[model samples]
Target chain A: MNGPSIQKPEIEFTDNIRDRNRYGRLWVYIFRFSTIIGIIALATLLFNIINQSSGYVVYEAKGDPAALTLDGVPIEEQTKDQLMRVLSSHLSKGAYSKLDRTKPFAERSRNDVYDLVVERIVKYEVVDSWLLWDSLTRKDEITAAVEEEYPEALLRFDVWINSDFLRRPQSSNPVIAGVRTAVLGSLWTIGITILFAFPLGVMAAIYLTEYAGDSWANRIIQTNINNLAGVPSIIYGILGLAIFVRALEPLTSGTLFGVTDPTSANGRTILSAGLTLGLLVLPLIIINAQEAIRAVPNSLRHAGYGLGATKWQTVWSHVLPNAIPGILTGTILAISRAIGETAPLVVIGASTVIYFDPEGPFSKFTTLPIQIYQWTSRPQDEFRFLAAAAILVLLALLLTLNAVAVLLRNRYSRRY
Target chain B: MEQIALGYPKSRNGLKRRFRVGENAILALLFISGVFSIFTTIGIVYELGKEALLFFRTPNVDLWSFLSGTQWQPHIDKFGILPLFTSTLITSLFAMLIAAPLGMGAAIYLSEYASEKVRGFLKPILEILAGIPTIVYGYFALTFMTPLLRTIFGRDVVEIYNTASAGLVMGILILPMIASMAEDALSAVPNALREAAYGLGGTKLEVALKVVVPAAISGIAAAFIVGISRAIGETMIVAVAAGAGPNFTFNPFKGAETMTGHIVRISGGDLSYDSIDYNSIFAIGLMLFFVTLTLNLISQQVVRRFREVYE
Candidate 1:
């Protein structure tokens, strides 16, 4: 009963829709392909790092540890006194004296002396190395290559990350190098960052959301904070270099407290780095905390007022308790950012090769990122391996902190 | 609660006064905290300006030559910034080429095409990409990307330390930023438009492209701008993989220096605090700061405009 004109229009429309659907499917596949690239990139990054961190190495000691052994006692098995003598006797008198002056060998443990002997005396130099995948899949090929490359060098599988990697301090030699000093410095700086940024950020957010009037001044402050968050971190480094390092050197270097080293002090201390990082993260915390505070229902505030509670009292008792979890969430993110940050610390003159742990707020410091950067820039392939291991440690620390934050956020969300 | 309120008598006016004083003190403290951000900005400008001004004040230095010249040999004392500026642009362009399309497409997929379950599973994975430190990415660029690139482009074509490797890794680093921001914009678009397109027999892709993308264009543009800013400011990747030699060439296969790379290289070396070379980095930093700041402000304005339209 339908007219030919109506049927013809319907058929044409159907054809057009079909053609569009085919093209749509093609575009959908392309979009999916783009998203897959991100996942692939992550996988590639992990694979590349893990591959470098472990492998086969053909190492040749310049002066073999066995030659230093008295009565066949290997260097690693030597007692503290014996190891000390071995290290001292092997080293040139001036070098030994310099080592002693740097840190007394007498006070160091047997393990430390043994490490020193291995590093200074034994001097294990990697002649050749292979990545983990090659070591595993092309085992015969690697063995042949090593043999062809150096018959004298010992061939063995090695995991770059071990207990020694965590315990030992920075060394010029990659075999003895570790992240101990850097880890301590990172912890100290992050500790200061949280102390400085957390309370101030939360307080500012509380004041703006709970107490402040809708005045132009308050509005300006709010906008300033938002802009600050977008500022490049290196600019903060410039500020830290200027204000904390130069202008406020007396305070940051602890000279104002009369406890700092007068000769070496230039305000390029952990205190300066931490305070700069604090500034870097302040806006982040304030923004996040503001969001948290704003999420609190107005009804709750009204209930407090109806109960004759003062504005401060209501915010303190009811609002703060409810908002604590959210504030913590923001703080966790800020701490993570500060911990991973390298540019500002570098700009503020954090020593890339610092061997000493941060002694106090005023002490010079280096962080995990700085350590990794320093190692990666070196021409040695072995330092790259060390950098990879340090990266794993850094990732573990960041992930644990972030996991806690996520858990808290989820728990609070579920409860409310 | 009622009994506690009643228990406060007129004789407890002293306690009330103490409480009021505490409140005022705390408010003042908060006000001080709020002003700290403003102080930081001022400190940055002042420090950068002071040294940058010192750089220009050097008797032999001509401002025009410094800005327009091509050579950046601090050893030779030639501080033309054109090479650095051009390298930065070339690297940033490569980064944009990789980031813009992939990030936008990923954002579209996450917001429009992906199911709820897929989006939930993928978002955190993308976030993990963001959480990775830049130093690590730098290493990946140096060791992995460089060799891989050399093999593909041939040994003669790709240098060991080239802009391509750094730019590629930087693109990966900023991909999460672009995707997340663009996804936010896409999600903000009302679903009613999508439903209307579907009712007219429009497919998912058609609806996403024709209906959602146009609606979210400003937001997507903001995401790309922010990505550019991030790429420009990134230090470790460029500093490590992009060679410190400031070259004016546009070839991605060759090594070149970026502004951040230049700053890091100079600062990391043994430069005296008062040296003209050290002060030169401050001038470079000033340029970087303004460029990034302007981009960020523009991005914010774009987002605001998008909000006005959609809301």
Candidate 2:
């Protein structure tokens, strides 16, 4: 008591949350740091997109401007970025083509030339960007006056929502950028992966649940299967490269050490991609499917037996129906993992791109993520915006699939 | 000798009095496919192992040097596994450092703190990060993430291909697994324990940390182990963001390769399977296989041994 003992505050209803922020400071710091990072990454992507999207300006002379014929009608025009590139290229090519050939480069007002280009776009001589942000915000005064003045000069504006972006192939000019081949490729490959993996996984599961004895033989088999599930997926790609593309093709073609079928997609096709992915997801499906089948009540099986139904009949008609929800859940999760897998595809060397939509299982193709990877890796900032848009599309697709799976799970669960 | 699966009560077959011999046949067939899958696994392993054996027999692949040496340039005649393994371990550890806490915190909030309505909204959003493809994550790491990390820290804190960026992005990639599975483990704890803790004047935090988590320790360990297993096997993100060099240092600012990275590198090349380079891929693959296999086995055993709690 002589040491000036501090008296602890008495417990009170109001004191329940004393220094509420103090106790969990570590956790709160971590939570805040994580949340801030997540938000910051998202914000950075968005801001970079908006910045790159604010491209440079361009201008063109009225009579001598570059012209393109649309539906046999000649139109002279320029978008800001396009105008800048064209002007820069022309100026670089020759002295006379420069905006102020006689004036000092520093003294020349290229801004006037830029305005003239914008004026020409406004004058209906050409179309402005169809980019949705600029279009929706419609700088009407900037574009409308030119259209009204150039009654004879047809104006074309770039609209971001045109069907062509999704309906066309990628072009050298990004103004006509599209993901048609890549989208179709992913769809077809995914279709194949699901088709191949699902039946095999389910069947393997059925065998495991209904069969496998307790002897060492069965145990070893089970242990090996579990280990197989843990193998790194890139190894599967190596297997595919050796087995599917190289060795088997030659043997399967009925040729002696010669896989000389010129027409054969150079041995890499959607079929190869699908099979590789199937192998990767196969172990997951089998394990989960087995668990799902095992979860079904034994009482139901006994009832089926009591009714004098055969074993196969009992399983097909009764056990399967009851186990539907678990099987579905397993399949959906497996599919979700498969959809996001990129490593094996890379190891197998998935075609970087294809100009045409896939015509068969043998046709070469790329996926959205691959395209996004290629685009984001580029030095140009415009491609980054395109990559972001593609990511948004991919995110929407994945979310919708997962939602459907969840919805089905809920709907089936209620019946049980 | 006529085939009759069953018989009426009036005229029972000799086999009906005991058990039908045919029952064994059906069970046998079911077990055969399990046997078949095992055979497939063995066949693949055998193929890889045989090639690797051949590689070791040659003077070119020095197993001792590969395992202990600092260099890992297989392309230009240097063979070292140490630096690659070190990078693999370092990146995986960094990823675990970030993901384990964030993921577990999210798990705790969902299980013990959030109302059902809040959980409903939060869980799906958490998975949003997971559903983004590994390739997309790789791009995000290279383009968006590296620059951000550079800005926050000084430029010296970053490399063209840094492990920190890839590891952090990979942490985000694997977060859903830890969160969802850990939540399952947390919820599996009996409500009675929580009630008893509250009865003893314990707060929600006390009940959760003391009773629920302790009870689910085995499952939580399984989650962490599985999460790390995934991080090790994950490929594209590391390949793109984490440079292919096998730097033996512990710096996350530097670039390094993992086993999966080496496999990708060889296969990505248009190399013939008969070559020494191609065989090296199999050798590395076998290593990856065993490493991940051990992790999975440990996880399975942990769950089996300590997970049970009677309701």
Candidate 3:
């Protein structure tokens, strides 16, 4: 019927091409600007952290180092015996014996003795500190302020993230405090988290992708996993507090194994923290593993089946090996999330001031994020600098993990 | 074949029988693993519910009062949750005000306008933004954003620990989340729709804004909802930047504690077990869990509806 209306209507084009193009260009710029905003935010965050991590500090020593010099030798050039003698004479009798009791001077290295002399006798206390930006641009102002405010204090530019900071454990005094214990705790917690979450996540993914077959139960399981992935991480901490820390205290505290330390008999151990993190990351791992498994072409499975293979055999021999790299990439990314996660760990009661390193799964622990959180909360400005330094360490760790994941995904991802 | 195949077939059948048992066993193991996620959900509900029940049962705390109360001082036994709830709402809304438009714009650009090279370069940057820890974001809020806010708005107008800084930094934290999700949704819109619009002589902006965006609206809505839920549930940022006490104030510059912030602050302290302080955090956690869960379910429903339209 429409064939009868063959005549074309008068072609009229709207004369707003210029306006449309202008708006289009403006919109594109807006979109581009949004992305630039994110980059700017990231750069500012990094810049801020780096700015705080190294700065000039005005420190006052409790006693003059020149007073302890032996036969006109400066404290720095003194021999190990001389340093020990200086420490012994300057330190109280109780303090001297306690230091020797903890670790005998004979067993201690010469540098260790010298450090003790400096820490105990010299006792450098930071009177004031300036951030890198101010330390650079307002150098004269800071110098003048420090001289007027702290006449006897020494002014020096200190990099907060030094080897000594990394080597020492946490202390109440910000001058000597370090993230050594927190770093060890993070490693231990993450090690246990991987051990707990990886295999279970992969197997669940295999089941959902292969064997579940769209059953109602499987659908519920799938939905549950998605919902769990969205659950606030702190809720997992509550669960850990209830389940791992309280209800299963015997297991988490190593009481059941008869290896409990009286001081650490509570369930706030690395094991509980790790398990909590594992649960928190489980949904992430499963979702990612499922994606990896689904990416394995169906042809691989069919080929295995054509060769008279069982379902598990096909999945194990063909699907898993093909999906391994993708799975690992996803898992590593999830693990990095766990590594940075502080909420649940805080809820699960990560120790904020633990000085000793985590000895095992049963030991009380504090993670790097916890250290950063605690340090940032302190009213003192120096603690903020310490937190920034810890943040840099954490960022370096997470970036390394992300880089490895990206490399693995790029290197081994199969085209099919 | 006629002479020796008899013994081979018998052994093969026996081996198959044994393999069947192993297969069933492995399947059972995998099934349990899949069920573990369900158990986790149950565990969360059970733990939160159990403690929350105890909290409600306390003579000092009634459900009605807890829901309607304004002050949340646990030491004085004031357990009203409105202060924390409103603070959370205010921060989340503030964050969404920033994240929603920016995220949608980035998504539209990446999906509709960006060249492949641009998308590739921009995507990793967003990923890095997402990968940065929230604690770092919290630090940024406290150290950089707060001071900047004070400078712009004036120190007298802005508290040192205020919701404005927390919400602003939180927007940055969740921007990548919304952008990537919305980008996926926009990218998923059948190209035929864009072509149809273009054939009708729609400009690039018109095609994106009127045709593609409306088509992907549900997915974008879901992304927005998820972003809000993330902002609500974000603990470290609010805890570190938001004030310690619960204050029912609508002003973004005023100090107030979110539910999450309260939980973190109280629980971070050395609370004895079975104390009202300890139990109250769980109650707050329970409320947080449900709010986030409801938001998540709604987003899932929206996403599912969107998937149905396309698939």
Q: How well is candidate 3 docked (DockQ)?
A: 0.50
Tell me which residue pairs clash in candidate 3. none
Worst 10 residues of 3 chain A by lDDT: A1-10
Restricting to chain A, the TM-score for each candidate equals: 0.95, 0.66, 0.92
How far does residue B204 in candidate 1 sit from its true spot (Å)? 1.4
Question: Which regions of candidate 3 deviate over 4 angstroms?
Answer: A1-14, A100-111, A144-151, B1-19, B306-308
lDDT of 3 by residue, A238-274 (tens): 8998999999999999989998585673999999999
Error of 3 at B294 (Å): 0.5
* Residue-wise C-alpha lDDT for candidate 1, range A7-100, written one tens digit per residue: 3444443357677789989999989999989999999999999999999998998987679987678776778988878877788999999989
lDDT of 2 by residue, A1-416 (tens): 48989878786457554354355455545544543444454455445444433332122234444443233433333334454554454444464354444343355344434443433332322223333355447567546765666444544433322365566555333444667777787788889899988877777777667654465665776677777777777777777665666655543332434434443555566777887788778778888888878888888888887998766667778888888787888888778777767677766666665555777676665777666666665655545555666666566577777888888778886333
Question: On a 0 to 100 scale, what is the lDDT of residue B275 in model 1?
Answer: 88
Off by over 4 Å in 1: A1-14, A262-265, A414-416, B1-19, B306-311
TM-score per candidate: 0.94, 0.77, 0.94
Evaluate candidate 3 and give its CAPRI docking class based on DockQ: medium
Query: Which residue pairs does candidate 1 place in steric collision?
Result: none
Worst 10 residues of 2 chain A by lDDT: A52-61
Return the candidate ranking by DockQ, descending. Answer: 3, 1, 2
Candidate 1 on B1-311: residue-level lDDT in tens?
12122213344546552246766677678767877778878877888999999999987677898989889887787889999998899888888988999999999999988999998888998999998888889999998999999999899999989998999889999988999999998998888888998899788888899888998889999999999999999888998899977998989999999988888877775457778987897899899989998999899888887653633
* Candidate 2: Cα lDDT at A358: 73
